[model samples]
Target: MNVVLFNPRAQKAHRRLPLSLLMLARVLDCEWALVDGNVEPGAEQRLDALCARPGTVLLVTVMPGPQLGVATPSCRRLKARYPGLTIVWGGYFATVYPEAAARDPGVDFVVLGQGERTLPELLDALRAGGDPTAVPGVAAWRDGGLVRGPTRASVRPADFPDPPYERLDMERYAARTFLGDRTYNHHASAGCPYFCNFCAVVNMFEGKWIPDPADHVVRIVRRLATEYRADAIEFHDNNFFAWEKRVVEVSRGITDLGVSWWGEARIDTMLGFSGATWEAMARSGLRMVFFGAESGDQDAIDGMEKGGLTVEDTRALNRLARRHGIRPEFSFVLANPGDPERDVERSLALVRDLKADNPDCEIILYMYTPVPLPGMYDEATKQGFALPKTIDDWLSPEWAGYDRRRNPRTPWITPGLVDSVYDFETVLHARYPTVSDLRMGPWQRRALRALSAARWRLGWMKAPYELRLLQKAWGYRRPEEMGF
Candidate 1:
């Protein structure tokens, strides 16, 4: 069997490792080829040469928003050209909308959540000229109907083979970031324990969480540090700090490696960490952390079932991170269903308070785009919102921005509200340019800060044309736009 895994163009010249495809490659029993559009020029042309064979399987890892738009047409043309080729779609986009993905002309098979198990099974069936749709966690349009197997969720990363990083040019993925000169990304964990109803992780993991053992994680990090000369690492796990013991162990192992690192965590969970754990994290060179501080209202947070996180908890976590000298970047889901106005008002207020409490804390404001789940999505439905049922519909101008998390096209959120959020974000970022933006000079930073100081302090987030002009002129990179 000829299996070629393709990572569609996601970011612009961003050197991100495709850990998803690498994981699948590790477990594949047959020979396979890998092409990353992020790094490879003429990625589709390479696929064309590799996929011209009679029994070729073109596996693609797709994300929800922009990547889906990118991969759809590419795969469609590939399929149209080589009608004998088999195209399989995997990753968050396929897992979230398996049936819809199956209905697409390009996607022949949709691999649900964890592909380590299901993908091999589906391949075994396909190799035997058997029914691929019969495999568990596989979905396909067959015999004029959509056939879907049982739903799949999270699994242990340790149970699988290590990511086959040796297959690719490690130097291609070694990009410089705020953490250090050369940075590489790793997903050490599989899922999140808590199910934030609006989160796609909850839908993929079903409230289950799993992480590779501390020793395994440290081994990989050690290799990246020693062999690849990576001075920093980013743990792209859904929840990197899911288990504190493993975190401490990993931290202890990496303490002497001298590699700066970053990860994501929950506000309430980290607040419960002992001082010893906090110290270990700091000594490990943990520089920054991301948190889903979903809302500013305690009641609203409680509604999201974020493990009893209060409005005060975000503030407390900010202080904790500050004490540890680790910057905390909070992502807020604004203009949520029902009472969208109140949601925006309270969340933006909290953003201001957070900045005041800790100058280093970063605020990422996102419009609430619901996953196809219960709770908030039901509310979104009540307020006239629905997920696109086809690939083309998802590419439409209104829905294309859906996964960017800034401009949600839900009816409850007016254009004024979206602009208000953008305006405030512009002023806020101008006042405090992101440290992730290393290209920004001291003069430009001082100028932006001075110009936006009055607007930020006076709560004047209207238009802010001056800030926009400077940001456009200087090519300022907001942390949100940069995907930090």
Candidate 2:
């Protein structure tokens, strides 16, 4: 079968063929083409070109909010251009809102939950000229009616075919800063074990961590580095360090392979491990690690249900990472429910303290948005805040803006906090010039200020796509060069 897998972005045009699509292609043993939705300015043009070919099935993956807006128009255009062509929509957004996604005129089938097994089955059925409505995990529009099927059983990560790395545009992705020069993406584990209120990972995977065997993980990394010439590998697991023994084994295996890699770990996992384990990781080429330290305030931490991490715990972990020469990237949320001005101030102060204490470490501050997962949205509704009426409402273009705006029942700290945090970091850098400086400089600072101002004045609603582009253009600068 001729299959085209598409990754669609909402605002900015930045996209690469997702590693998932490559895996899907290998499973079907079909001719596959991966397209970035934003490569052209208009979705119609891109969709038309893809639909122009005969006997082609388009599998479009979409994330939440404006990205859905971006993908929906394209799907609609494809349906109009080639009425016989099959259109399948998958991803987190489709999983969460299968019924709504199925209702869209452009979407023929919505694959809820993991598409690894179900997608191939649906395609095979279509190839056999079988009824798509019989496919499990599929919500389909047929005969002027919608048919929703039972959710398919989850598939183990090991069950997935090794991703078809040969099919990817390796050079294009390698040019990106985050992916690094010789980057290969692999998943050692699937699903998240945690039940954080604001997290969708658990909901997406149903609170299960289907980890691949350590040997399997080792094999993939070895191939990626030795054969694919990957300079680095990224463990795409939601929580890499959830299992201590598995992580240790993986670390040892990576060391054995003599390759560099990066992944995300919860603060608890770091604190739980011995210093020697981290040292081994560092020796094995674990150059960087990301941690989601939502807040420094203990009350806020409790509210977020982030156990095993206190302000002090984070500090100690920072020290441990520094001792091992692993660059620790800390992610912080500026606002949460019931967060007052003081909480915001304390969070900022904590960021300043961390920067002061570990000048070499990287800290990222983000404004809080209530993700539309079960627990978080339930809390938001219980608190009497206006819940996002549709999936599109959750697409926050403002996230790419410099200045933040307030929403109903959201804490007062929401407005101006982005600018305030940027300013705070700027001042902190100026006050402590001796520290390893990672601040935005004059030109970049002015650019952010201008972007922020434009976003605030014009609003993200008017030009959602442009805001995404602006975000990528100005998102990352060298820490030493950028004031914050």
Cα lDDT of all candidates, in order?
Answer: 0.88, 0.67
Q: Per-residue lDDT of 103-156 in model 1, one digit per residue for the tens?
A: 899989999898998988998998899988878889998777779887765678
Estimated TM-score for each candidate: 0.98, 0.80
lDDT of 2 by residue, 1-484 (tens): 7788887754332233366566567677677777764443564565567667888899988876456767877778778878888889888777766666777778878887788888878988888998776888888766656687776766777777787777665654542334355565677777887777666675577677788888888888887778767777777788988887777788888786666777888887787788778877888888778898878787777777665568788888888888888888787776666664556778877776776677767766665656556554566667665544333444445432311212323434454654565555434323323212223345654555554454343322233344344434645432322212
C-alpha displacement of 359 in model 2, angstroms? 1.2
Off by over 4 Å in 2: 9-17, 37-47, 125-134, 140-147, 176-180, 256-258, 374-376, 387-419, 425-484
**Model 1 alpha-carbon miss at residue 482, Å:** 2.1
lDDT against true structure, model 1: 0.88
Roughly what TM-score does model 1 have, to 2 decimal places? 0.98
Backbone clashes in model 1, listed as residue pairs = none
Q: Which candidate is the best by lDDT?
A: 1
